[model samples]
Target: MSAVLELVEFDAEGFMNDAKAWTPEIGEAIAATLGITLTNRHWVVINFARKEFTEKGEAPSLRRITKTTDVDTKEIYQLFPGGPAKVAAKIAGLSKPTGCI
Candidate 1:
């Protein structure tokens, strides 16, 4: 785990315990664990996920992301690799997205 991870609390699946406690630094640290380096494009998705979480009180699904953001399904898969919505939500410091299996 990174130093930032050590300072925060997460669930067994590694989602942050509190979205309110999330910071950009912490998001980067979480992404590091998944071997992801946040790019501007990645931030687009992350920021959108955070916004969705704030608005809906839950992380958005992949379909929702693709439908709402400029990013498409293929690019989201390319960017996030293993389960776009789930990974993006984790990095965004939100709970595991509903309906993600």
Candidate 2:
């Protein structure tokens, strides 16, 4: 975990325990820990994920992310690599999405 993450409360899986603890800088730190560099495209997904979590009380699924955002499945995979929705939710300081393992 990054120094920034150390300052906040995270679950065993590195998801933030309190979504309010998140900041843009914290998101960057989380991405760095995952070996990702935030791009404009990344921010689009991150923002959408956070907004969805705030309004809906759960992380958005990969399908929802693809449909609502400009990013598609392939691009999301290219951007987030391992598990697009999972990684994006983590960086956005949200719990794992419903369908993610």
Candidate 3:
């Protein structure tokens, strides 16, 4: 957490405007706010998502997550509750993924 960037600055959806400032501690804090505990399964999805965003400049879709990361949509939903892509991205400390409501 930076001296300046407060978690409240993030959107209602919990995405920060300056995603580059994201850190694992921030991610954990965001997840706690969202009522999600970071599990190893959750970490796998988050890591895959961040990697996809870095390589493709876009967050991977639910279908993409299933197709590429070998994580099925059902498991994703279980891991993220609410909206998987959006919640997961916020917890991953990335920008709100495109095409996610």
lDDT (Cα) of model 1: 0.93
Q: How would you encode candidate 3's per-residue C-alpha lDDT over 1-101 as one tens digit per residue?
A: 44434644677655776666777777777787777888888989989888888888777777778787867889999999988888887776677778745
Candidate with better lDDT, 2 vs 3? 2
Query: In what order do the candidates fall by TM-score, top score first?
Result: 1, 2, 3
User: Per-residue lDDT for 1-101 in model 2, tens only?
Assistant: 67777788888997889888799999999999889999999999999999999999999999999999889999999999998999999999998898745
Deviation of model 2 at 84, angstroms = 0.5
Q: Better model by lDDT, 1 or 2?
A: 1
How does model 3 fare in lDDT?
0.77
How many Å off is the CA of 80 in candidate 1? 0.3
**C-alpha lDDT values of all predictions:** 0.93, 0.92, 0.77
Error of 3 at 27 (Å): 1.0
RMSD of each: 1.2, 1.4, 2.9
The most accurate candidate by TM-score is 1
- The candidate with the higher TM-score, 1 or 2, is 1
Error of 2 at 47 (Å): 0.3
Steric clash count of candidate 2: 0
TM-scores, each model vs. reference: 0.95, 0.94, 0.83
Kindly provide the TM-score of model 2 when superposed on the true structure, using C-alpha atoms.
0.94
Query: Residue 6 of candidate 1: its Cα lDDT?
Result: 85
For candidate 1, lDDT tens digit of each residue in 6-101? 889999998998999999999999999999999999999999999989988999999999999999999999999989999999999998888745
**Lowest summed lDDT window (length 10), candidate 3:** 1-10
